[model samples]
Target: MTSMIRMFSLAVTAMLFGLCFAAPASAQATRTWISGVGDDVNPCSRTAPCKTWAGAISKTAAGGEIDCLDPGGFGSVTITKSITLDCAEGIGGAAGGILNSGVPGVTINDPNGGTTPTIKVTLRNLTIDGAGVTQGTYGVRFLSGKSLTLQNVSIMNQGTGSVPAVSFEPSAASVGATLHMTDVDIVNVQNQGVYITPVSGVAVSAFLNRVTITQAAIGFKVEAGGTATLIDSNLSNNGRALWTASGAATANLEGVTIAGSLEAAVFATNGTTIRLSNVGLYNNAFGIKTTGTGIVQSFGNNRLGPDAGSIGLPTATVTQK
Candidate 1:
């Protein structure tokens, strides 16, 4: 009996020793921090923040937020889960910045069955700069995501090959992705400022409020399976201010302004349609150009400048009730 009792005591002691020395599993934090002077190996806590946005994202929870500690170029990051990066409420009102070259400033690709398992992203109070010469490919390249909201965001100098400031081309699984842009400004983009061209048979929608696009090939382009509404927005000095290509693409403009377009102010082709209400077209080569059975319906409340090279008549003037 004494021998058995001694063996039992020894086993219990050994088990407790192993439990104490074993390493604890790593768990993501509900909130992570990033700073210019921080290190990536840190825990991303307030006192021990990470160095870059890419570093802190791995430490942050799926639906959590990563906040900036101060003014820093957090570097380019790829988001694969639902998260928010808010720099407006950080230590100072210093907006977070991303300076990218030869790559996208931000990429949001959230597929299903991942750890987070959601496809929503929000970006606020940031400036994405595609540095000149070796400029980045895209300011924001959204391949697969449910929705993306940009508030007070500025993207500029994306002079690469046919890359827009914001590209929303979702995959089949990411169909019906929604985009909301408020107080957003895009400048000097090589392609369209905002391109909403999803995959075939997949529809996407966009809402633009107080958005501005300047010095681009096209300000806003909506292709097949795409729809957009622009309110109180400005598209100026572009090859084409607004364009809807292919079938099933629709665009509505209200209280919007198109000025100094080298080509037509509004171009619709391939059975697409555009509706205008309370819109102003000034100093453009043409007010509205439609081809290939495309249509432009006006509510007769638009202001077209008399100096335009030509003003294409609307297919029909809609009567207000």
Candidate 2:
């Protein structure tokens, strides 16, 4: 009947070109899985999983990986590219897999004249809980990434007022950004527990290992041309534990433990530079406070004070061990 109606119009034009080439090859899934009974239109599959890390980061694959197959709360995620949000194994530990009350439980905005100019983010074993319930100003708000890695993470009670539970301020096109925190724990953050500001002329760097900054008003706030390297860290009961400000800020504290700081366990101001090794300044009212032309370089196996107050500047230098 006219050659079977032109072979059913050439099989409906090859089934509409195989459904437009299989819908972008199934939306480019390099790896994507998120389950707490997932269903973000079911394609984020490790058996169709997807129940938020903003729906498995829109079916992940730009440098993909979003694996968390058991515990839930996986909300609040605004990472633009280069991803890896691994909840290492024990899926539901911190009150059943949470990223509570969120506004920023992870926001790494990457996209400025793209061709993947930067953007590298990796967060593992996550337990970001702001259940003290203002629910987020930041528990990782690195506003434009080049690199940010946090392992065994636990950023607690995120701040609302002065906002900082890991906020590496980067946006002058994400200026020289880099931060790597291992075995991290930033607790009760109501102001500043790791806020490395880098946007004036780009120079941000941070490397903290075995970190812990508790009860923060300010524990590690390295501003202005920043640089920080704290190992085996613990800055406790903070009003201000380590605050290096303005001029070319640099803080390299090793084996640190600054306790009960009702202000200043090392507060280097304007012309900042603080380098203390094997540090432990307990019950701090001021174990090391250097003013406007600040500099505290003590590399002694440091353990200062019963009733601490050591103000230095005879061109501050101490090398006792």
Candidate 3:
């Protein structure tokens, strides 16, 4: 009986030893810390988290990620890696917001090496405010990438000449890419809510998926040669709701509501082909205005009634959580 008990005890001890060493490696993800005035030169641990956003960007491994928790989510940084940086709110990182009312939110410069070796970056559940500050650069900018998705994010009150809340700038060596922005709220931006410009015939695409814009000088501006989609969205009190510059681009505005704009809510300039279905156009200016040789084709219901102004389309539906 004594011999059997000793053998069993030894087996249990061996098992526990194996678990202890393996546990740390399994949970060995890097946890970078942040202070109210954190900079990049510091060690990225909880106690020695990097200080500046630029600092954290340098430590992120190519395709690795780093989340920063601070009192102000400021600074300009370039991304060439597959990273998920959530300074405001997201899982696996910080869940509180520190974006001051008057500061730069984030500036994303694309890979300067001509080719971007990274994959996708998903930023969700954050608030970015550039309240009449300096030219805030951009809330988020992408030059070369496979995919980029922004969900449940807010970009409000950027400076007077700040770029767009979200911008996609394609490279000449780029094939094509997609930017999926869903459930985004942009207001009081001087330029645009979401902007995209393909590299002359580079064929990149931009999708303002489920975006809501209020009080923007220009709402969703699809520059020349960029194909864009505005689905299930609301643009109110803008200079122009959907501004298209190129005729080569196509805009499908379905289930959208535009009220009180300075100009035509939807302006299809150049040779742009704009399709509208079940869309509502309200007072202040022309609802669906197209200039030049651009074509505005409507197959869906445009007029619902005098009191009712809303296009009922499934793709244009937005349910806030």
Write the residue-wise lDDT of candidate 1 on 37-132 in tens digits. 989999999899898889999988888888888877889999988998877765433567788877899999876722222479999888898875
Better of 2 and 3 by lDDT: 2
- lDDT tens digits, residue span 162-238, model 3: 66767777666555677888998988777877777766656767677678898877888776667777788888888
lDDT of 2 by residue, 54-116 (tens): 877877888887888776677778888888888764333222235756467788887861323
Report lDDT per candidate: 0.87, 0.79, 0.66
For model 2, give the 10-residue run with minimal summed lDDT: 89-98
Q: How many Å off is the CA of 274 in candidate 3?
A: 0.9
Which candidate order results from sorting by lDDT in descending order?
Answer: 1, 2, 3
If scored against the real structure, what TM-score would every candidate get? 0.91, 0.42, 0.76
What clash count does candidate 1 reach?
0
Considering every candidate listed, which one attains the maximal lDDT? 1
Model 1 TM-score is 0.91
Off by over 4 Å in 2: 10-14, 17-35, 39-41, 44-49, 52-55, 58-154, 157-173, 176-192, 195-218, 223-236, 239-242, 245-247, 250-266, 273-284, 295-321
Pairs that collide in candidate 2 are none
- Per-residue error for 163 in candidate 3, Å, reads 3.2
